[model samples]
Target chain A: METRTQDTASFEVTPWEVRGKVDYRKLAEHFGVKLITESELEQIRKLAGGELHYLLRRGFFFAHRGLDSILQRIEKGQRWALYTGRGPSADLHLGHILPWMFAKWLCDRFGVELFFEMTDDEKFLVRDLPLEEANKYAYDNALTLIAIGFKPEQLHLIIDTEDIKYLYRIAIRVAKCLTLSTVKHTFGFTDSTNVGAVFFPTLQIAVAFLPTELYREETPVLIPAGIDQDPYFRLARDVADRLGYPKPCTIYCKFVPALTGEEKMSSSRPETAIYILDDDKTVKKKIMNALTGGQPTKELQRKLGGNPDVCVVYRYFQAYVDDDSLVSKIYNDCKSGNLICGECKLILYEHIVRLLQELRERREKAKDVLEYYRISTKFR
Target chain B: METRTQDTASFEVTPWEVRGKVDYRKLAEHFGVKLITESELEQIRKLAGGELHYLLRRGFFFAHRGLDSILQRIEKGQRWALYTGRGPSADLHLGHILPWMFAKWLCDRFGVELFFEMTDDEKFLVRDLPLEEANKYAYDNALTLIAIGFKPEQLHLIIDTEDIKYLYRIAIRVAKCLTLSTVKHTFGFTDSTNVGAVFFPTLQIAVAFLPTELYREETPVLIPAGIDQDPYFRLARDVADRLGYPKPCTIYCKFVPALTGEEKMSSSRPETAIYILDDDKTVKKKIMNALTGGQPTKELQRKLGGNPDVCVVYRYFQAYVDDDSLVSKIYNDCKSGNLICGECKLILYEHIVRLLQELRERREKAKDVLEYYRISTKFR
Candidate 1:
């Protein structure tokens, strides 16, 4: 219901609205989810047979429902799958990849299948964007996922509009369990909301459980997505048992912050969002202008040090920096006044530039292999 | 807007709700369409190259928008197409075939195409019926339409869930023009209505104009359906200009009254509705029990003449009796109280029994050639 920034402003998060400071712990309480604990991370690390993912270790994916059950199922040698999605509303930004990045890591770590959905139909229905544009965005976003190096055999990229013949059959089964009252309660739908928007949660829920239908068995599913998307899963989980499928478990992630630190990174705000395809100069410029935890005056900053807790740059470092030692040094230096905003920005800019350059090259290569990721074959 | 039956309780008519005494003229006014005038009927007769259809001549098809324009376009050597649909919520009954029968005549007379849609998705969405049941009903309904003798080459049978890929693209375009406000206003939809119900108008609109899209030209279109369905076309016509398609013309038919002389023939009321698949014994039983306008006393009936206008038996004779001379004889005999309710019921039963038997045989024949009428091929 509400996401207050830990040390700053209070905010609210819905699939359509994200504002102010997002207090993950308080947000978890409001959403009625358990915060992912140290023991859970240790269990996942053990299952993965390696160091914990930087996202989990750094508390990016910090809350969950039924993570314990999913882990227990996995420990018992039952296969578990990953479910995540993107709404093709605009160009992909760094924030868009946060859940997907974690999803890919989970698939590799556990050798399980992944269901990646592009909700072009939802965007076309809810947004004023043309179907043509929404379809193009779906393809572009799929390319971004492919660039992250998901194995072709392990991943199933499902575009809603393209594969609806399969999805709609299952979607109708899900839609039957949902009442107009329930969708209105969950999504804040009103008399003026288009019918497509009202019916969309069913499609989202269908994809979450589609793996079980495909495998002809109940495979434990883990959805790693923004906390804003929790309402859809809540509705999905509510209806899963009635539809004779396993309720999907979820690991809710925190919002990857905007450059301004005023809200989550959004495609609509070009100045605040560092897009995946943003050139080196643009990325650097955005990082340099980003709001950080440093004091206004250089002298004041030198004496009191910066608040790494409120820094957007530190959040990016926490998201992308793999080495724990390097992440700790960055946080300690910022808090001890050993690092300045300009120096820290330059370091983030260099790291992001190298990362994006590799991704851009990989995305180019991904164009040729898109057919392999399409999940239509699995349905047939 | 309400439809109060003359000398009966008032009823309401929306696309979703049909009740009360349906005043065709008032219903026309409420739906913002003009009653089809005598002159328009004459014009249609001349275009049809003989006597007008009994439905049109009798004012059963009594309301329209753009009928004159469609006639003019046909006169100018341009083609026109027919569009009509059924929501597969129940078994097809006599009331369901009135429009399709008229549509078949239109296609034959005009040498044009017909797009017959089966809204199984809407049924699955709106009703508690499962997809399998809805799909089965769609097939059953399709067989009945095929039994009406629509030329395979001239008719394109479309099933919504099966042919969604083609429909959805155009539906999205049609949906873009519609706002939540307009659909709510047109269909009397509430917040509590399912989203599929909200979005279904777009699909209906898509099928209405599908011929133009397939031929890649602006072919004039005509819709013949129960007056209850006029609201969908009104919304579709409102958005047609912006979507660059010609506004569809419609001829709204009155509901064939139920056998009990109450409301319309409804599949939900099995005793009142004579289904196409009903056995001979069931048909005879329903007709014998039907309410007629005969006097309570035989002597009083001979003195004061019966009311043919209020007789359900007389209405059925009006619908089925094709010969003008015979129809006049039946009307005159009923008004003069010379024809007893028993004799009229016998005559009506013979006509329907023959009609149903022929339809059943044709329906059985229709089962094998179903693939021929499917429109999915055209889209590919």
Candidate 2:
């Protein structure tokens, strides 16, 4: 599945950073995860009452570690819950919301609970930002998650600083099982790295087993995150059996591409990302300026056609275009020179503007629902 | 201050392990703490209303970091509390009780609150003990502490596993300020050391600043512990001002010597330490077998007398005998030919039996007092 493109720049990916051109298939191999097979997709489609989430159907969440184990556990009548998180180092963007949207879909389709972690503590440990600033980002990110339509009763939104008691005790046990060398090798940490940073893999790993502790049983968990985060869960899975908890299954997603098609989207690069709260005008402007794989001029574009394989706008269409037929039509039109860069930009812009306008309204309404999702109340 | 004795084995000391012949004065110098001076003792006596606790008066609690600053703050009418802790790795022993006893005296005289941390989590992280077993030790240690006559209302007994929320938020901030190099150099940690062990200094450091956070002001804290634990508070003091909290002052104690006259009394050495719960016969047997600085033969012992300076019995008398006159008499008798090893062991045996019997009674009575000291209820 791994392929190299002649014109595409090579890339590197880690939990904290991404650069150049990322190949999702190559990342899957490098991380030792399997791409979603047709059988697995059919199994999920059948389990979701004869349909699949757009993210899954379009191969956005196309990689996994233990999805088959989760399916088998479910078939045996055992329940599995979803665990995912936000680092909250910056404002929420569509890239951040993508995984949560899929998580919400899983929650509704499978009728399972969700453990949504806001790692404000990790943000402070790993970034140069102040603790208070990280806390502010956590609050802002929580609202964006609430706006994503997750059912309050089934969701446990955990802010690391506010609900640290829930994680820290178990995290110590997990940390003991982990070695400094393992983290150093896995996460590229050096002696110069802060101790908090060196110790943070445990905090991230602890979230996977939280449901088992809460329910007082060996409940299975499904962690849906970008493939970049696989190392922590891989370490968690390796230790879970020794700790007397079930190994958590992982479903990995490809990163949302940057607006300029450089690589993955990031809040640190505002010009390359579209924030969740961006206005329709702002969303349109960003998409219009976004990178695409068309020829240099209209004459060459018409004669040679375009390369949608490297187009940021085409990737957006794949992520947001719910109708499979429409997505196929957009791809056909772009490859056949039927759609120019300006036309494709218009199409992507319309979709993003509509999505943001609706999300902004829901985000305004979600303020009242935040309390129900906050797990800080469960302990305190 | 550094000295090498030809017959004395060279040793090293860290918070985790102790070896060889430890020189108290050298340890003070090595740890960058000052030995208690006559003037400071006089100030403490005046502050305690013309009396010093036996430990302070006898030079058991011998060194300090900021005792002068604490005294100055108290003179300026600023409030301060006492913070001390035990790692619950084994059963409660007199070596563990010595500092808590001194802390009790400070609490009674100055009417300050006590933060007694039972680091059950630390035991699990640092040792090969199960979390449940560590928790069991914590309960046993808490009962022994309760038996020591610290008023429940003025004491807050925090078990790290049970009251983690209070410590973790602050610990993260402290952890962030610490670097891997600092901890590795300070704690002598290697790559094989678990992440929990590498990260635990912050947990220990956080207790020093908890009073400042809880009281929401510049409340000073006094940590009374063995000089071995000085590194954690030293690191705490380095970070406290930047964190906007008053630096914690320390009153360090010399290690209580083992019955074998080895440098330290350790719970890991069952034959060396006298457990508070040891039966009367067991206590007498241990004292009878204890090492003494007497001549090989009774005839030579009578002619040459004994060295009370290095005798375990004389040190025990110093630790347990409340009356200064009684301790002086015992010292003088041992120095001259007036007291022999048999008579000294008998006298020490009688004192330990009485002390243990009284403690056993108080321990039975203390079951009812534990509820008031536990901070678990504050969170639950």
lDDT of 2 by residue, B38-119 (tens): 9999988987799888888778888899899999876776889999998886567778888888888888988888998998
Q: Return the clash pairs for model 2, or none.
A: none
**lDDT score of residue A51 within candidate 1:** 68
| Interface RMSD, every prediction, one decimal place | 2.3, 1.0
Which docking band does candidate 2 fall into?
medium
Give stretches of model 2 more than 4 Å off: A1-9, A294-307, A333-340, A378-380, B1-9, B295-305, B376-380
Which model scores highest in DockQ? 2
List DockQ, one per candidate, in order.
0.42, 0.79
Supply the TM-score of chain A against the true chain A for every candidate structure.
0.95, 0.93
Q: What is the lDDT, from 0 to 100, of the residue A136 in candidate 1? A: 92
TM-scores vs. true structure, each candidate: 0.91, 0.94
Each candidate: what lDDT?
0.82, 0.84
